[model samples]
Target: MLLTQADIDGAVGDLSGVMRRTPMIASRTLSERIGCDVWLKCENLQRTGSFKPRGAYLRISRLTPEERVRGVVAASAGNHAQGVAWSATQLGITARVYMPTGAALPKIAATKAYGAEVVLEGTTVDEALVAARRYAEETGAVLIHPFDHLDIVAGQATVGVEILEQLPDVDAIVVPLGGGGLLAGILAAVKPRRPDVTVVGVQAAEAAAWPRSLAQGHPIAVTAMNTIADGIAVARPGDIPFAHVSRFVDAVVTVNEESLSTALLLMLERAKLVVEPAGVAGVAAIMSGAVDLSGRVCVVASGGNIDPLLLSHVSTHGLTAAGRFLTVSATVSDRPGGLIALLELLRDLGTNVVDVVHSRVANGLELDEVAVTVSVETRGPEHQREVCGALSEAGFLRE
Candidate 1:
């Protein structure tokens, strides 16, 4: 479908009363670090804790009354399911959603709470999508696509319009690309208004299928892989979205898991925002040095539907990546004063003890010795190395 400026403007007008005009907040820390003015489009704080509701609500609102009465069906990993369910509820329409069994519990609960009939059908989104399609055909329900549809694309385009208004001099925008709706919409709206503004897309390195798909000029199914950024863990790119992405998107970069965790942590600690892994992928790309931003930049934090457990893990991972957490094992004598002496040595190096595990028989140490695992929190790698050196000098054989 041809996505013109008129089409985008009309969609924005139709949904203006329903959708939010989310704020565009500046990130001084990021701007100073990257040598560019950086703004964070915090869509993670949107109505459904994601930007999906913008497209979902617009799509459902535009449907005919008969279609709404027939109900809507959709398949999503998490965020889209919540968006569709919430949007359907707003339109007073019955919604049936199929989600992978492995989808985050918080997301499942949120979707169900939004008044949709949630179905746990498969282990992967692809499997759930197949079931959703079959159910839609059998029940004659209007199938609302998560990202591929023209209406959905137009709906998401409103974000670009908001960004333009918020930061007219925005030199570039970096978006997290999954099924490509967000990227496509932003590109459609931004490129037309400011043709020179660079539009970049980011994807989880482990689940990056768009690069290969774009190279082949078709939507290719990336193997459904596990990633912390479940929101953008799409196996395939949308056909309609792909068209716009190819035309206007300046660059598509991939960031690793470490980068994602670090970015999320930074958002929580420095930016005072709770961003999910997917929401932070744009910043992850920036931190990973995958994209060059020499001018004003916008990083779209797409969602904040992170699981509590996952957040804990991401936090720990971030600390570890930043060298604030360290784990090392050493062999010490079995005598009574040996463990205390080792502790004293660590204290001398100014390393704070966080956790310690003493193993005697299980670690296969000699009968006269034991393996002691120490987990310490230090200032950084230099402090950690200094502590390790102190241990070694104290005659603790480290592994």
Candidate 2:
């Protein structure tokens, strides 16, 4: 069924007390960088750490009493699993979530913590989906698709309603696109009201499918999908959402892995918001110039359910990308004070040493030589260059 403005209005009314009207905060840093008044729709702070519940709850709530009694099953890498689980618990129904074997540990734990039976199967979400479907067929359970139904689209449209109410002057909206439910919903709700406002969708370059699907004039499956943005790493576009995208979305873009990491770090460090890689795709698009950033722009911070270990790795990668961290290996004399002297040089150069390792008896080391690997924090690229220059001038040959 095609979703209309009236359907979205009904959804907004139905979801009044069920969902949180997440904050829309102004971002001065992003505004200055993009030369526009930037606002962040902070769905990352929503219940279950994503906007998934907005659609999940609305879909499950509309289920007949018999369907609810049979319980619900869903497949997700993280966010959607939590949404379905939380919604099922709220409605006094049983929930079973199928997750990929390699899904983030924290997400799996959180899904189970939310009172759902967690099943770990396959290596990707598509694979887990197979298991979920088989279980639904065998047990007569209702399968709740992540983003392919009319009700789901209408539920997600409420986010668009909130955006317009919160920022009526918003000229552009950038959102992370996976199966296109969120983008489709926003377009259905916002386009009719403000035809001049632009709606853009972003995807990870490594896992993008919409561009190819649009070119083919139908949903096309991506053969190989790999990216750090697992939450949005969908291989196929949902038919229901693709219809709305083709009709209303202004443009779609992709951001590289480096930009995704940098954007996540920027939100964490500069915006003081903990956002996942997928959640920050809109921000990445803006920072990388993938989207037109004119007039009052709103970028959706879609989710924040990130694993701590992955966060640590992304943080280090972000630091490297921003030129705030450096690693150098140099050969030095095997003398006792050789390492100390090199460290003193770094200290004199005002570089903060993060880690250091020294070794001898290596392929490039002479009998009286040792290789010292130093990891240091610098102010920026220029500061790193200065430290390297000082080390080279002090007779520490970089290896």
lDDT score, residue 42, model 2? 98
What stretches of model 1 exceed 4 Å from their correct place?
A: 362-364
How do the residues 175-263 of candidate 1 rate in per-residue lDDT, one tens digit apiece? 99999999999999889779999889999998898999888888899876778988888888888999999888888999999999989
- Residues 215-280 of candidate 2: C-alpha lDDT, one tens digit per residue: 888999899988999999998999999999998889999999999998998999889999999999
Clashing pairs in 2: none
lDDT of each: 0.90, 0.93
Backbone clashes in model 2: 0
Q: Given candidate 2, what's the lDDT at residue 94?
A: 98
| Superposed model 2: Cα runs more than 4 Å off | none
